[model samples]
Target: MADDEGLSNEVNLQQRHRKERKELQAQVQKLKHSIPKGDKRKKKEITEQIVKLEAELDQKQEKELEELESTTNEPSKVAEQLESLTTVDSDDVDVAHKVKENKPSRAQKRRDKKAQEEKEREKRIQEETINNLMGSRNVESETIKAILDKKGLQLFEIASDGNCLYNAICHQLQQQGTEASNDSLRKQTADYMRAHQDDFLPFLTKDNGDIYTSEDFEKYCVELEKRPVWGGQLEVKALSHVLHKSVEIVQAEGSSLIIGEEGKHCDSPLCIVYHRHAYGLGEHYNSVQPKSEETVDEFT
Candidate 1:
C-alpha cells in the first residue's frame, strides 16, 4: 500500500513538472521575440535568463519528488504523526476543520477589506493627532465667511475620509433629489482625465516634480478609480471639467478659486468650501448650502 501511494505521488509530481516546463518553454519563446534583432549581447542575455529559469524549475521538481517519495516510504511514521496531531479533543479538531472548510474566497476578501478599513481609520487618527500638534485647525477668514453669509450660503461638513471630495459632490447632487455615489463620481473623474490627458497631464507631476508621462498618467487615473486614494485640487478640477459645472472653491485665505470655463457650464453651479485644515485634521471639503431664508434648489 505504501509503495502504491508513493508511485501515485510520483506520477502526480511528474505531471506538474511537465506543465511547468511547458509554461517555461512558452515564456522563452516570447522572450526570443523581444530580444533585439542583430544585437548579440541582448540575445545572449535573454538566452541566459531562459536557461536559468528552466534549470531552477527542473531542480525544484526533482527536490519535491524526492521529498514526497521519502515521506510516503514509511506509512507507519506518517500515521503516527497524524495520530499525534489528532490527540486533541475531537470536537476541537472538528470545529477547526469545519472552519477551514467553510471559509471561501469571498469570506477571506471580506476579512481583508475590514482589516484595510481598520488600518485606514487608525492612520487617519494618527494624522489627526499630528495635524493638531502642527496647529492645523479649521480657519475661515472673516471676509470669506461674511461673503458666504451675505450670499446666503451655509457650510455643511463632509466626513474627512479619503473620499471627502467625492462624498461632498455626491451630497450636493443628492440634496437636489438626484441619486449619485462616490463610485460614479470617481469614474467620471477618471474618464474625464483620460479623455483630456493633454490638458491636464502637463500640470501633474511625480513626487520628484518631473512631468508625468502618458503611461504614468493612465496608471494614475486607474489607481484613482480603484483605490481609496485621497482627492485633492487635481481631482476637483477633473470633476469640474467632466461635470461641465463650475466648482467654486471657497478657500479659507485667498479669493475663491473657480475651476472650469466660467461661462460654459451650468446656471446654478456646484460649490464647495475648501478647509485647508478642518477639525484639526487633513484638508477637507464641505458642501455649500443656502441659508434657510433663501431657499436655493439649483443644482443641475
Candidate 2:
C-alpha cells in the first residue's frame, strides 16, 4: 500500500509541477505583452514573479522526488500478507493450486514499465542537480570546451548518476595503470576526515557562517561513508590525503586548484575537468586524457 501510494504521489506531484510551471509561464508572457517596454518597475516586478515561481516549482519537484525515492524499496503491506499466506500447508489441494497459479501477464508488463519510469526519473533528477549546482557559479560550457581543446586534452565522460566524481577519479587512475572503485574511495575519504577532524573543522562552516560542531562533522563523515552524496572539493581534499596523490581540477572560469599533501609522497597527478551546462544544463566530471607523443608509430 505504501509503495502504491508513493507511485501515485509521484505521478500527481509531477503533473502538478508541470501544470503550475506552464501556468506561470503563460502569466509571465501575458504580463510582458501588456506592459510597455519603457516601464522598468513593471518589468522588474514580472521578472521577480517569474523567478519566484521557478524556484518554488524546482523545490517542490525535488522534495517530492526525494520522498518518492525513499519509499521505493517498501512493498505494499497487502502483498506481504498474501506472500506469507502462500506458505501454509492446507488440506484443500485445489485452493493451494489456485494460489500457485501464475500471475497475470499484464502484471509483469506493468512492473517493467514502472521500472523503466523509475530509471528515467532518477536520471532527470541527477541532471537537475548538476544544472542547479553549476548554474550558481555562472560557468559556461563552450568556454570550458575551448579551454580543454587549447590544452590538448580530451574528456572521457562518466555517468552523471551521483557517482560522476568518483568514477572520473577512478577513470583517471585507471589510465595511469591503477585500479580503484567508488566505494573504496568513499570509505578512505571518510576515514581520513574522521581521523583529522581539526584539519578540516576550521573550514566547515554553514552558509550563514556558523561553524559545524564536532558531532555534526562526525555525522557528515558517516553520511559520506554510507550515502551517495555527490563528491565535492571536500571529498577531493580528503581523497587526495588518503591516497597520497595530487588531484588537479581544471575549471571553466577559475584557476585550477591542486588538492593533496604536496611532497615526496605524491606521485603522478590525476587530472579531471569540470564542465558547467555542457551535459544537459548539468555540471559533470570527466577524465582529462592527453595525446600520446608516439602515436602513429605503427604506420597505419
The total number of steric clashes, by the backbone 3 Å criterion, in model 1 comes to: 0
Q: Per-residue alpha-carbon lDDT of model 1 for 4-75, expressed as tens digits?
A: 776787788779888998898899999999975434457778989987997698568756865775676477
Candidate 2 residues 204-299, lDDT tens each? 887899999999899888888887676788888888877778998888778877887474587788888777655652666767677543222110
Q: What is the lDDT of residue 2 in candidate 1?
A: 57
Residue 47 in candidate 1, Cα distance off native in Å? 61
lDDT of each: 0.75, 0.73
Residue pairs clashing, model 2: 1-76
Which residue segments of model 2 deviate by more than 4 Å?
Answer: 1-139, 279-282, 291-300
Backbone collisions counted per model: 0, 1
